[model samples]
Target: MNKSNRRKFIGTAAAVIAVGTAASAMPLSTGKENYPVLHHVFFWLKNPDSKADRDQLVQGVKTLKKIPSIQQLHVGITADTEKRDVVDSSWGVSELLFFKDLAGQAIYQTHPIHLEFIEKYSHLWSKVVVYDIIEA
Candidate 1:
């Protein structure tokens, strides 16, 4: 290749590297305070089959509301979202809880209230999934 071709290739490579680096350096926002350690516990449930199942889920939410260790508790079906391509807003029910720290989260996991909640709802649904996230 000639000098001009080599120069053009180098310039294109540099531009690509710069763009890639900039994108990597940019941190995506979680829409919440960047706590040193964050525990995100999620649960997905199959559609309820009976009135009994629905009733039991309600009892589970009520039980969670009574737990002091559960700083926040939410239970409901996902709402309609206009931005369907950017977000997932579909599920049967969800419960959200906040703790002071990791220790608090552990405590919540073993707390009697939580145990009772599990017992109450475990049979209400056909499936469940949980995700715990700890971020720095």
Candidate 2:
């Protein structure tokens, strides 16, 4: 995708990573605390060619911001631009979420809104992948 075009994947890997990422952060030996976790989720749709399915997924992701524990939420899709050897374009939709701390993330997991989102939208995707990053 071009710089002007923006969109964003991990598949079956998502659910496992989402839960594990918060639990698996490694602190620097210097003792700096990990204050925030960046949770990036990738979704490969069962009907990757369907615009309706992809749009619905993106909208569903937007609803996650209602959860108080989520500091930020961004919904995106695959971009149409240059394909690099390292770029992943298999997924149709992606969400980048921010949480203040692991506790916040844990709360988000059980939050009614988050649960509802999964129940309502899980069927759209055939696979999910999640990546969690903590600032060094």
Candidate 3:
């Protein structure tokens, strides 16, 4: 290879290695005591019939957002993007909730607000998936 080409290749390889090392060494979360973790729950609707079910689920998730224990609540409708193997995007809606701890999450789940939401929108979707992860 030409001298210029060899230099460019070496520089690119070094840059890649540096980025990979930095990413691996980065800390997950700040060193705060009892750092809060985010709980993500997704609902996959088998029936993609009409706007009615989506609207109901949105309203129910909004009610959940109003509860006190929940630090954050986010509802995401699947985007028309490239598919990934991990998520089964055949469903209609995905709900994400964040809490300080398991106790807080449990309260959110069992609270009257959440119960009411379930009663209202439970039948709209056929399947539900939940995922919880704590920051390191």
Candidate 4:
């Protein structure tokens, strides 16, 4: 290798290493927000084949985002993917809610919006399953 070319390569590599070292010494994020409570709800629509029913349920779930205690909300229909024994894609719609703590989730459970949502859209779902998780 030419002397000049080798020197340039070494310089570039040294610069990259120095930058990486500096980055490693610094905190990657300003602050970390933790949500220890996860509320996952799977809804089996009475009319599973009806796109309209699924859409209505998704829209209703989206409204739950208005609840102040919910840190994050995600709503979606079953994914179209390869069949697997562990993956239950039978649900017509699903809602994954994040809460800072159990108290936040408790407030969300009885929130007016939640009660109204159940009253208005409960008929669309024939079966509902909820899994609540708390990180240790």
Candidate 5:
């Protein structure tokens, strides 16, 4: 390429890199706060594709919002995506719970609302996996 073309190409590449760096530096809304505890649960239903089962699980998740200790609750279904070796698409529903701290999570575990939710909806899922995380 000519010198002018090379310079233009270099400038464009630098601009692209700068834009990407700026975007990455911006704060993302992952909702993690200092010392917050996140409880993530993935459920595989006995009938994974059953709309009724999914609806029931969603309802049960919503009920947990009654517990004051919970900072946030998000319920969602598996996303549609290309099959990949590392992706686990077997789960039918996912529940994300955010608690202010470990104490808040401890209270949530034994809260009546939480217990009722489990008692009422435990039968819907054949497999459940829970991952708890604490922000540093």
Candidate 6:
């Protein structure tokens, strides 16, 4: 290759590498907030078709938001989608809770509001699955 072509190719390669390095180092979250711990819970209700049961569960979840240690809370119902082999729509309700750290989550676990929530709403769901995640 001629000197001009070689110089252009080298410059292009250096630009690509610089862009990739900067992208990889960028923070994933918005600068205003940082939630490192995530607690996800899925609930399979005893009577999935009953609106009363769903409403009761939703109400119970709202009370949980009052807990001081919880940074964020989201409660949702499973969405209707195309039936597929991999889809698992058995869960009637899903809840996501975010905390600043594991210590905050620990406090939430034993908080009176959380315990009260369980006592009030445990009988509505037959199965529950919880997944906890920490940011790397």
Q: Give a tens-digit lDDT track for model 5, residues 75-121.
A: 99988999999999989999999987899999999999999999999
Can you write out model 1's per-residue Cα lDDT over 1-136, one digit (the tens) per residue? 9999999999999999999999999998887643333344334455544545565676576676675655555565555657667776544566665655677678777888878778766765665656565664
Tens-digit lDDT string for candidate 6 (1-136): 9999999999999999999999999888755568999999999999999989998998888899999999999999988999999998999998999999999999999999999999999999999999999988
Off by over 4 Å in 4: 1-27, 30-32
Best by TM-score: 4
Best by lDDT: 4
Clashing pairs in 4: none
Compose the digit string of candidate 4's lDDT tens values, residues 37-81.
Answer: 999999999999999888999999999999999999999888899
Q: What is the lDDT of candidate 3?
A: 0.80
Clashes of each: 0, 9, 0, 0, 0, 0
Candidate 1 at 33: error in angstroms?
Answer: 9.6
The residue-level lDDT of candidate 2 at 135 comes to 65
What's the lDDT for residue 94 in model 4? 91
Clashing pairs in 1: none
Clashes of 1: 0
Off by over 4 Å in 6: 1-32
**Model 2: lDDT of residue 116:** 97
Q: After TM-score superposition, what is the CA distance of residue 25 in candidate 2 from its true location, in Å? A: 39
- Candidate order by decreasing TM-score: 4, 6, 5, 2, 3, 1
| Candidates' C-alpha lDDT | 0.64, 0.86, 0.80, 0.95, 0.92, 0.94
**CA error at residue 67 for candidate 2, angstroms:** 0.2
Question: Candidate 3 on 23-135: residue-level lDDT in tens?
Answer: 99988886554527777777866467667778778778877888788887788887787888975667788788888887888888789988988887888888888888787
C-alpha RMSD by candidate, in order: 12.5, 20.7, 9.4, 3.9, 8.1, 7.8
Q: What is the lDDT of residue 74 in candidate 3?
A: 84
Give, for candidate 3, the lowest lDDT window spanning 10 residues: 30-39
Q: What TM-scores do the predictions have?
A: 0.55, 0.72, 0.68, 0.78, 0.74, 0.75
